[model samples]
Target: MQPVQMTPAERAALERLVEHARGDTGQSRRVADFLLAWWNAGQCGSYDLTTAWGVDDTIMDDMCVVFRLASRANSYPETLGCGPQFEAIVRAWRPKLVE
Candidate 1:
């Protein structure tokens, strides 16, 4: 599916809504930024996401939400296509650091 192109204003409004819906905390914001950067870097794959969290899945869902929203805003096809991959990663996420 072709991503709807959002105007700058629309994009900002959606971003604000997402940020607010996700708690709008410092850590949330930082995680959102990190995901955006990672997506922009053309990075993907279950292994990459797993390593990115370092086995601590505390914020996995929230990060996935941020990633989805950012993907829509930027029309990133790869990230958008990875919904199932993201879910799988979240499902298998470990609660503590992997040794």
Candidate 2:
């Protein structure tokens, strides 16, 4: 499949997300850290947030919220997360299941 062509704004947003997600600090940093650690550990299967990340459902939900906002930011510029960049990070660290 061909790659999606991102606008300047979208590209900028993606870069920002990559920076923050992989940064040394920030709320979403944990998400990136977990992803990296799990992937590096050869556990690239489905992620049961509560069991895998050792957090409760509430924290899992919050993490999902952060991911969703980042994924959907292209449609809603005011959102505080990265759009396609977040997707790229996830794809790199934890690819989706094949149906």
Candidate 3:
């Protein structure tokens, strides 16, 4: 299926997430990059990539770590709440990233 388009709000939220991710430590940044790449590929509902990357099978908990890292990077109280928005942005940006 074709990816859905993102609204302006979603775009803004993704920018915020990226900004937050930028401040993460090395390991956390690796996790964030993997999440972003996976999300961008329209693969948010599974942990296959995480497992392949040697991430713990408990991906939800791993995502929480990413969220915490992002929060620390950006001082955004709302950072942890950005998962849905990030997913949307990833879907929207997938074609561009792939090309």
TM-score against truth, every candidate: 0.30, 0.32, 0.29
Could you arrange the candidates by TM-score from highest to lowest? 2, 1, 3
lDDT of 2 by residue, 1-99 (tens): 323345555455444445555544433555555444323335434434444354445545545554454354434322333345544555644556212
Better of 2 and 3 by lDDT: 3
Candidate 2 lands at a TM-score of 0.32
Question: Can you write out model 1's per-residue Cα lDDT over 1-99, one digit (the tens) per residue?
Answer: 666555555445434533432444544444433543434344322224533453225455545555566656565424335444333322333212222
lDDT of 2 at 33: 50
What are the lDDT scores of the predictions, listed in order? 0.43, 0.45, 0.46
Best by TM-score: 2
TM-score, model 3 to reference: 0.29
Question: What is the Cα root-mean-square deviation between model 2 and the actual structure?
Answer: 9.7
Best by lDDT: 3
Q: List the residue pairs that clash in candidate 1.
A: none
Candidate 1's error at 49, in angstroms? 1.9
Tell me the spans in candidate 1 whose CA falls farther than 4 Å from its real position: 1-33, 36-47, 53-55, 75-99
